[model samples]
Target: MRLPIVAGWPACTVMNCEADQAGYGEDKCVTHLSEGELGGWLSRLGPEAEIHLARTQLAKGTLDQIKGAVTGQDDVPQFGYLSLRRAEIEGGVDLCYSRFSKEVDLYGLKVSKYLDFEGVQVSGGLDANFIEAPQGVDFYRAKIGGSLNLEGSKVGEQVRVARCDIDGSFLLRGCQVSGNVECYEVKVSGPAYLSNMQVVGDISFRNSSFSDGVQFFYTETSGYFNVSDSEFSGFVEFEGLRIAHDLIWERASFRDDVTFDKADLSGLVQGSCLFYKGVNFIRTIFRSAVIIQACARRVDFWGARFEVGGTLLLRYAMVRMTGAILAGPTSLVAFNRNFVDIFGDPMDEFVIPHEDPNVKLLDMGSVNAGNLTLVDIDLTPCRFAGAFNLDQLRLEGEWNFGTPPSGRVGITPFTWAKRKIIEEERQWRALRSHPLVLRSGWGDPPDNPRDVPGVAALMTTYRQLRKGREDAKDEPGANDFYYGEMEMRRHNQSWGKGERWLLQFYWLLSGYGIRASRAFGWLIISMILTILLMMGFGLPQDSPKQEAAGTVPPGGGKVTFEIDKEDPRNPIGDRFTSKRFERALNVTLNSVVFHSSDQDLTTTGTYIEMASRFSEPVLLGLGILAIRGRLKRGS
Candidate 1:
């Protein structure tokens, strides 16, 4: 409702209701200054004026009755030129500001209701503290100098100062504003504060400047965001806001990651901290993975998620999920498990803790989005394992490369490389063979023989391990240990899987072996012939023929014998002669016994000594026979 224009009203004071309305058309109002009359009322009203309205001017003096007084008027009392210049309303409610002329000073007023100083100059201080209304302030173009203090006041409506010049921040941190704070295009030289209180509606400070800390802590919201295009000199923090909707920070410049680390966000987040110091989402859960990063400053999604699914590309950007994480991608992040689950991957290039506080990265365990493309990938250092279908997954590389991504692959090198260390450990340390008996020649011919040099080595190790003087014990007792020890040792040391290969070699060697067996067989047959010759023809006792044959590593043999010629029935009994060598390759044997025979002989002694002397050739021949026997079996 427009006010009347006959309003040549004088200023209000502690006097009458129509005191300002008395100056209808008079010059006496300014001239007739009485003892109790205020200067402002006298300036606007003529001498002929009689009413006075000074009682309601936030005055402290006792009010006097006016000539023409009435109550219950809706119109505001008037203010003659600069009358509110240095007025002080320290603690009051429902004060109005629309009546004053533009650019007039109205400082230090502790107002409650609307202080509509719109487009006017508050060259003096404006104090709107302990007020009842929030939209109680409307400084459309007001100039404040002495720190316009709105320190502590319950605000119920909007506090708009759009296009207004604020040499200081419009600070309202602990003050709850139930309505929106519309300060679009306002120039503030200081930092803003709309934090620590609930704002039921959207609060916008678009295109505003705050030179210090701009913070909103523990605030609860129900709709759109409260920040955009706002410049803050110091760090801005919204650490614990309970936002019930989407919070966008597109192109917002802050030295930090638009930090929303502990904030409870409930809708789609589609912005970037491309240049932000860090946006920590350490343990914040989201409903989707649909996050947008359009040239973000930096992101630190230590533990944040988009409960829904979508891509979170850090294309041409850097990000980091700094530490202790359980977040997934709204879309998909190919940065790997350790990058997401293990947060703060120092070596990753695309992600570093800086500007962006990662608020939308999800934790989907392993990749659940189809499959990863691993073609032409550097599998050199990477070990891939899982249930995967590589048929559809595509990896980027040139087709002209040596082997195509899906070509017939030979993974021998790769396989060995992956398991080589373990296999080597199993072969060497894990499968160590501390031999109990190092020797055992099972089917080794007596004449052609088993090696004896390895005996000491076998005995030393066996004695130390077994700690028993009884015998050396090879695990399997023969094939792998020393021959002498094989017959003597007793222990079971073959307790590993690698030792199982010995079974096949064992059966194959447990037969009449070719070369050594035949040589031993030949020598044995010659011994028997010599013994028969001595017994049948009395081949002169120690027959000078047999003493010259013996051993071999290559091929040789030896024989010896004994003979007795006394009793007629003896028939050259107990005599022996044998041979089985050619030059150094030949072997021989001989023996005899007569009336002067010692206790080591009898009529059978001749034959016994003969048999003993020919024993070497006998054994060699047997070895030969054994080899032939094996060949016969093969045939």
Candidate 2:
């Protein structure tokens, strides 16, 4: 089949030849010209001549003649428009170190061997779409001024475009490569589209730079994709790209945003990339572990998934994953630590520096992992409302948690107690419209009013966290979570009236039995009150004095003695004396320890001892309980 010719191009004058005529009064096509006639015509051709060899079966040694005819003797050889569309080449074609002033169209060309364009320059462009090369195609160190279109091409062996520069867009979509695609040290001034590409071997773009955007949507590679030391100045999209092996981007930099949305990789996606803007990996799937050491402004992993044997590791990466899900056996680590993959096997040793990363795990509200391990990650802003099996989650290192807001309100005398709390509970209490919202100088309301977690949800979250800490043998940390759980229970309106009232009292008196100072302070105050009451109304006026009287009877044979005493009365006057204070002090001190002081007292004093005996011991016991709660260790 003859290829279509451009406008203003004449057909060959030779009979039965459908190829376009060689310009400059050349009536015969290149296929129909004799050896001497071809030499004469080649000598007559100018730099601006248009030669079309469409549907021409170029015999052996004929392609070399054509290349020699177009090549100039100057340092930079320039040729005119050359079309080889639908042409059949009997041997390999080598147009290396030549310059094409206009477009070189090779559409639907059949090459018996490799087609080399090494060190070639195409000013207009190079279109080789649908060209089939059994050997391979090479564009090493070539420079294309305009677009280089190679879509739908099939190469038997490797396609090397290394050290090449393309001024315009580069298209390789729908291409099939039996061998590797090496694009090392290449620079594309315009966009690079390689979607729907399938390669049997590895695809490397190492030390390359794309000034404009790039896309590799739905591209599949049997081997790995290594873009190490590359730089992308514009947006990059790798959506739906599938790699059977690893995808490496070590030391790469992206000036604009990037996305690997919905991409699936069988092997790891390890990288130390530098992203100036956000990089999204939404819905991406990784069968093996992903170890990224990137420093990006923002890196999103929304809806990304990891398989059973895969782990998501972000060492020294400052990323914020708000509302992220850490389901299955995933472990989200921040600082450097020895960790294991999902199958309890040791992972590759990461040599991350032990510096404090200012990374925040904003929200893990959807974490339902069975063995999620968080190490040295800042969780102060995290919300765990929808988490499940958190009681089995392993938390290591100094993982931070939210604390109660401090400072006192206007016209209020006390500040909020400093206690570690969950971010969801804090947000719930910060809501202005909530019934139990902290309206007294707590903090501002939640950013989104609808996102505030319910008290029951917070209660469950705190209970699980408390259980997890307890299982780790961290009683001090567990107590903080327990305090949070009690706070949520106290504020829950659905609780029974009596239970709520009891909770309120428990919180007010001893901070749910976790405040030793509060309980002890009340114990001291109770003793003082008991002592004052005894001095006022429970002491007698004075001690009763005994007297004896003797009477003589019947002849002075014997003398009889009679003794009598007055009952103890209440204090009459001068009761506020030092002597009364000493007796009252003695009674109060013994009552506090449940011991009796044997002393003279009225009926009121006897009843006062009975009340102090019951109340003082309870307050002291609560103080001891609070102290134990603070220092108790898990068994």
Which candidate number maximizes TM-score?
A: 2
Off by over 4 Å in 2: 1-6, 13-18, 46-49, 309-328, 336-356, 435-437, 440-444, 494-496, 543-568, 572-579, 598-608
What lDDT does candidate 1 reach at residue 559?
47
With candidate 1 superimposed using the best TM-score fit, by how many Å does residue 470's alpha carbon deviate from the native? 58
| C-alpha lDDT (0 to 100) for residue 260 of candidate 2 | 88
Index of the highest-lDDT prediction: 2
lDDT of 2 by residue, 1-635 (tens): 12233666677887887877766667777778888888898787655556688777888788777666666657444577788888888988888887887888898888899899999988877888898988999999999988887889999789899899999888888999999988999999989988999999998989999999999999999999999789899999999999999998877778899998999988887655666667887778877766655655556776777664344455444454433455456666663543343455543333233534445666555656454777677778776766678898788777887777577644567667788877777767677785542554546778797888778888888898899988888888888899889988888854568889889888877888888887778778877877777787788888777878889987777888889777778888777788888999899889889999887778888898889888777777788887887788878
Question: Which digits, one per residue and each the tens of the lDDT, describe model 1 over residues 1-635?
Answer: 01112234455332433233224343233223354443444344421223322112443321111211211143333232232222333233322332332122232333344556565444333444444453456666656542344544566567666766666555566656677656666666666566776677776666666666667777676666745555555677777877777776544556544666577777766444334354555556565444544444445555454455445544323344323222332332332322221233222224343432222322112222233222222221111111122122233331011111222224322111111111111112211132312111111222312312132333343232222211322222221212222222222224354433343222223221223433443445544554454344432333232234433545545544445334323324433333212111111243211122232223453565555455554455445544443344211
Backbone atom clashes (below 3 Å) for every candidate: 131, 0
Score candidate 1 by TM-score against the native: 0.41
What TM-scores do the predictions have?
Answer: 0.41, 0.87
Question: Candidate 2: lDDT over CA atoms?
Answer: 0.78
| Residue 594 lDDT in candidate 1 | 15
